[model samples]
Target chain A: MPLGLNSPQIVLLGVNHNTAPVEVRERLSLSGSNTPALRLFAELPSCEEVVFLSTCNRVEVLVSTNRLDEIRESITKLWLDRGKMDSNTLQGALYEYHGTSAIRHLFRVASSLDSMVVGEPQILGQLKDAYRMASEAKTAGLVLNRLLHKAFSVAKRIRTETRIASHAVSISYAAVELAKKIFGDLTGKNGMLIGAGEMAELAAQHLIAGGADKLVVANRTLSRAVELSRSLGGSAISLEEVGDALVDADIVISSTGAPGIILSKDQVKRIMRPRRHRLLFFIDIAVPRDIDPKVNDIDNVYLYDIDDLKGVIEFNKAEREKEASKADRMVEAEVIKFMAWMESLNVVPVIQHLQEKAEAVRQKEILRSHKVIESLNDEQQKAMDVLTRSIVQKILHDPIVYIKKGAQKKNSEMILDAACSLFGIDGLEDTQKLQDKCLSDANQDKTIRKPSPN
Target chain B: MHKFLFQITVFIYFVSTVGFLVHIITLRKDAERIATVVLSVGFGFHTAAVLMRWFVGGHPPLVNLHDSLSFLAWAMVGSFLLFQWRCKLKSLGAFVIPFAMIIMTASSFQSKEILPLPPVLKSIWLPIHAIICLFADAVFALAFCIAIMYLLQERQIKKKRLGAVFQRLPSLETLDAMNERCLTVGFPLLTLGIVTGSIWAEKAWGSYWSWDPKETWSLITWFIYAALFHQRLTVGWRGRKAAIMTIIGFAVLVFTFLGVSLLLSGAHSYATWLK
Candidate 1:
């Protein structure tokens, strides 16, 4: 992709859950290198502000800088170091979204509309945790804090006030449901789980393929299998007697740590003779090897390993995408809300600036004509002051009116920028400083205000 | 100054009340703002006229039927001003200012003789009681305005009209907050006023609970408003239910203020201000 010359003042450089893999991500986890990345981010002379959100799925560096080339260089160097990439390999596999798109992306990510799992609630909490940690580390400041908080509020409105989260089934729930469909009323069924994992425990629960006549937990370690069996209301069996277990078992799910196949073709063939090829279902779930591929060729045997689960997962993925379309609509509305908040921020400063400017003009003119104004005397001056203030207020009202109208359209930013530029709103520098100081300080003075009885 | 301001006050308030009706039903902004300004001007004129009456009459202006009606009208406007400060329901001036103006007109028609103050109303507590109750009523009236706005806004949202009025009107949540705030401030004030009035009534009538139309309707008013506040806080009341309840509460207050006084021929015998 060609990079535009008029790139945004700030650019984001990173991969998210949408890009990159777990193996590549785990190494670049921000926790390992820790303070150096943040220090470097701060130390870079061109980088005004920096925030890094490093989740298991993604590692990103958000920088505030008008200098694009310099920020890009620093970000690229950081990525290479984190990814342990060769210099030549920095060619592709990286992406950038600038300015509005970048901010919108942050909002979406914080709201979890862009998560690997659609409408998954955990991403929001994770993002918040990242933001909080950044704050405590003195890495995330006012801009990020405000952006994140506003994003959270937008998300909250979407979650509470919309049906965006309705009927969102978890992966575990889908897995169990699939199991029940395959088993078709699991009463008086004998099943053996070859490994004792959380998945097996969950599968053994009453929600899923339960009500087995006998449940066997076979593991390399007999104690572990025994413990798993006890927790899951089943019996323990050894990996050595795996063939014997397979003979009696109506269903077999094998997920064990084996350097090679524990149940080879020869073993299954012998078991077939003893068991008379009883209609058995075999599910091999281990990463390397648990059951032999040749064993699947036996007659009256149905086999579905991890690879077959992929097809089912793909179907689930498509369904999740359909649900995510609904979530996306919610996200779009939420983005508009957040934009409104940001626009309101833009309008507020301009309003305050206008008010202050008008007040200054009124005070200066009154003070300049103090002697001539004395004909009005004390009572008349007070009345005239009130009248003058009202006139000023009336005069000062129209732009705020327009600004409010423009607020709904997200045009407030352009309006504010133009106003600040046109009026030479240098006072805003002081205002910005004041805002930062307020944020940095502890908010100890909390008051619950109740109006006085009329 | 006294007679001139009084007539102008009554005229402007009456005109603004028409404006209020126009704005409330048609929901016109210019009419609303105009009504607010007109009623504000009327309030200014009323204050001037009432001040003159007190100064010229050499009394607290609660001395006779005429004086008391004038005082009641003054109290209503005063209460309206107090609420308008916080409530931001200046549109309500169209309804309330006319009510006040009509009371002033009624006072003008009453016998202008300066009768001696009844010993019952002579106590310092009577003014305080009257002031607090009237102000609480104003707050309730403001809540009624919020409730109306809430209903209108709710209707617009439900219909998805998204018009200018809908845009300007605060959200249902905001209106709910305003209604709650009004009740929060108004309730205790009403409580104090009722306590004071009851104490003064005990001294004069030799019984606190006389079941006079005024007293009975006042309790009814209190019960209705108290129920509104309770329903809102306790029952998680919002939107149409709260809005309808608020409207009903205001109707009860108006009935206590006007109906019990005129139609019912109670101890509170104020001649009908409306022609």
Candidate 2:
């Protein structure tokens, strides 16, 4: 693809969960502390700036370079060597986006629209970590710096303006959300997990992560309960002890394989006095439902079977999908704005250089006539300064407007090159110098103005 | 002048009520903050109005229905501000400020003319009795709002239909704890108010035990709260039971404050003096 002479071409190449299986992702994933990989990407001859992001779901290399083909070949070779995979095997798994599409992809990723679960928040943190790593490795320069920061703000805007991440989308998370609604903060609240079912264990884990004070594992088999308790950093109790545990436990996840209800409304009612009628939440994920549905009848006691949790997850997932479309539109608008800024980066330096060249000529003429001007009064000298400055501004105004307007169109580089050659401005070297200066100035402004990341 | 200040205070409270209602719908922190600031300013104006009434009337402003209702609204705002400071329950104001606004609006419609102090109300016990009782009423009013919130939140959780109110209301435990706090504070005040009322009654009426309609209703209100307070401490009667009892207790307290005077005639009938 033909590109502007000074525009930094952004290219993104990656394999995410949708593109590759876990096995391939695992092989290609870089550890958080992988500064070496970032350094290698930055040191590539064709890569002007680089940021390497490797999460559990994706391994993406974002580079700003003119020689895209060379960088793509080198990045592919390095990825293949690291993953021990052949080109043909990885060919179908790899995906690439160039220029504006690359930027849109980055923005979508930061906003979590490209997440495996669509609205999960971990990707933004992972992206931030990658950006931080690149900064520390001196791999991300002017272009990547601005791009990543823009991505962060775009993510924040989407989060605040859209409800994409506001709902629980998984069964275990839904259970925890309901518990929070009932009990508010989970701090100091005790949880009891009955049976060793995978779903029950996962719910227990979520409760503990939500700040539940303690966990008690109860199972028909004492050894299994002990092993699960050991892994979960909680105590173990036999199935017979589950009744006694009810008084102390505030949240209970019961998933026993029993044919009959293990916890009944009458049994919970009997324990209510001892429990002080504190809120009780029971998540019964068993096929037949380990806790009787009638237990929900007890005041301050809430029961949700697997189907109920699935209902919540489905409702929330639908809500999130609705919000995700809104977020996608917001991301699209932000991408356009950012791409405009990127396009301006190409023309901004040329405009500045044109102004500088005219000022230089004007100043040289003024100095050449300095002896003649010494006879003039101070007011006349001030007038001479203003006169020469405005003359230079008027002479360069149309060309500057033409270049900026051209930057907004597809044939911007042609207009920019024509303007440069007509003005006798060196097309390549001076543009590079001025672009570097402009980028540094922008970087300084960003450092001063950036809000502290939340 | 004091009446004008009171009107301005009511207007400011109305504005704050709107602010809080908007805050509830938008869930904006800045809206809450602005509403709280507006409410505080109104509270200041309210304080000045009450003090001006006290100064101009040459007595504590708790004699007639208008004065007592104004005092009641003032005390409610005071209690709410205190709880808001301590608990930071953001949506509590959304429930509470509107109630205060209604009380102030009701007070506005009542006769604001200051009457000559009644001989029966002319004693040290008048201020002590009326102030303590009305302050207790204010605290119970707060508990009433919290109970409503608790019920709404509990219903949302029980029905498994978490809605906007569920998200805004605090946890069941927090509301219950606040209820218990109000009970602990308001119960003692009620007891003291009754004690002072009887002592004032003995001094003024030549007898301490009269089954006057207001006095009898006050006793009944006391009994309900005492029972709830007793059960809460001893048998741990709380959550739904406590919330329901609080609502019932507040209802009876309101009746003792207003219903007896308007609906029934007795020595405690301040409505007779209004005419």
Candidate 3:
């Protein structure tokens, strides 16, 4: 028979970027004003605590409840009714994890290992926000509070030990990285943007952050260039003066949609002779190739098109994937440790039952013997009571050690069931209430050492 | 006794080579530390064997194929270790230690008997010329390793086929900078070696510029690196072009050191020292 404590199990139901489309996810996403959702979850049968996490890519509900079936059905119905989505269409889109698997999932999500980018740092902040909202709404209790704190520590550990977030994984980031490769140091260098387009402006911002001493934005329209440059604390120049401007600029970022080549080999070659000491890096992130390809042949010139930036992003993605596996191992280890702690907790109630049953039998035998031996002195009766208690204690020692040791190992449920049967323990559902009381008492004694509700 | 020490050194180097290769494949940080330790042990043994040979033979041990190969391996390991200390480039040991192992293995196949020094070689310039030339070759070997790594990193970045191997290697910027450093330091040492050798040549052979194949190839190697330096200083060839140029220069240098002595007939065809 299964060990019966009627304790609440952790249940997690979610839809992430991989499982649901943006439209479906948005329909389920809860805002900070999620009092309605919180009230609905709190009213669910047997739900002791709940936390709802909603972000652009995912919407998750984590709950601790004994009636898993009732909570799952109620939450599914509530989500479907709110979204007005057909159950058939969204049937296989939702994922549900329970017990240890649920806890592991929470840790992975908090650490950003389950993110779309694998290593983005935004998920931790979003998780913290979800936790805070749950706290304010009175939906989170002792169980979830502890779980969330543990998840935060796990996330912090993974971030400290891995290079998952160290590399650039975006197109704009790749452009900056390439500039660094050429110049060694971006400080004390001049960065010039050839067009006032969004991509050029983004690259200009990255260059400025990289410590470029000067920024020059050049465009066909002088007013647009000036407006963009002024906002970034840089100067603007007309496109006609770009050739002369190239003499001082160390890095050039071009993303104009013009049909013709903006910079040619002869133009760059002519400029290189006058500025022979400086290296020229051309980031041509344009469709029709703003900078001429032949210009790459010119001395001291390095040109990278959009395709090159894509390569850098791909490489960085692969690197993050490698680090993800290391994070996975860490998550697995933490899950095992948490499971062991839970198992030890489940055995606590069984141990209490066994000891209490033995004490009741010993007390009855002692009181009966005291009446039969009323001729003896009160001191003699007390000595007999002490003697029986010592005998019972000596008999209980080996069994207690055996059960506690078994609880630390795997498959601790079988050991707990055996102890309950051997002791003739009954009414476990009633004992669950006692277990809950004792858990709160233990938590009061030491918050981190509380019995697992499982 | 020295031969036994040389064998042990070779075995240690082989183990270190495996260690570094595993570090590259697995990306285990502990493997890097272990490999460096093993390589240092091998270097210590190799140094002991070389010193023993020098003392017993009453020379610098530059008399035969075996001695020259052993000396080259020693120099390669020494320079690579020095670079590792300065740069902490663990991935680089994957390339350099294995190259040293191959040279040591080749040296093991040659006869271990020490041959008598030639009467013509009995001069103060002998040690000076050989030591300086070997030091130049060792520095070039490091440059070659960095150049190859630069090309590999550049290829992965360009082709977009990055895997675990790509991540284990150093960044393209780091490899490029290290290559440039090799040139800045190595070129002067090479120029000094050639100048000292030419001076020794005039004293010994009554000529400063013999058209010997080794001397001619050495000049060609020098010119290749000179061209590299010129382009690097004047035009600032930064990434891929610079890497490819250094690779080409390394090829000519290898040919000058090995091919000219072993394949061609010349006064400096010193491979017959064993015979």
Best by lDDT: 2
Per DockQ, the best of the predicted structures is 2
Candidate 1 residue-wise lDDT, A1-454, digit = tens: 1111111233466665545556555645545675656665667776766777777766667765646547677767766676577655343445565544556667667766677665567777877776776677676655566767777876676566443453225433443333433344456667788877676565556432455678888987899999988877788988777778777886677777677777877777777656643445666667775788777665445456665555455555555566555656766666556545543544565666667878988999899989878877789899989988999989767866876677567454466555656656665644444443332221221111211211
DockQ of each: 0.01, 0.42, 0.23
TM accuracy, model 3: 0.81
Give stretches of model 1 more than 4 Å off. A1-10, A16-36, A43-49, A64-88, A107-122, A137-143, A150-174, A179-224, A231-310, A336-349, A372-391, A410-454, B1-275
Per-residue lDDT of B109-221 in model 1, one digit per residue for the tens? 87665444554456676567766776677667667767787777666544434434543555454566677787887788877877887887788677777787888887887
Candidate 2 has a DockQ of: 0.42
What lDDT would each prediction earn against the true structure?
0.64, 0.85, 0.80
Tens-digit lDDT track of model 2 for A375-412: 89999999999998998888888888888888878776
Query: How many steric clashes between backbone atoms does each model show?
Result: 0, 0, 0
Instruction: Provide chain B's TM-score, model 1.
Output: 0.75
lDDT (0-100) at residue A362 of candidate 3? 94
Candidate 3 lDDT over residue span B35-117, tens digit each = 88999999999999999998988887877878888888899899888888988764899998899899899999998987778
Taking chain B only, the TM-score of every model is 0.75, 0.98, 0.96
True contacts kept of each: 0.00, 0.58, 0.18
Rank candidates by DockQ, best first.
2, 3, 1
Q: Candidate 3's error at A153, in angstroms?
A: 5.3
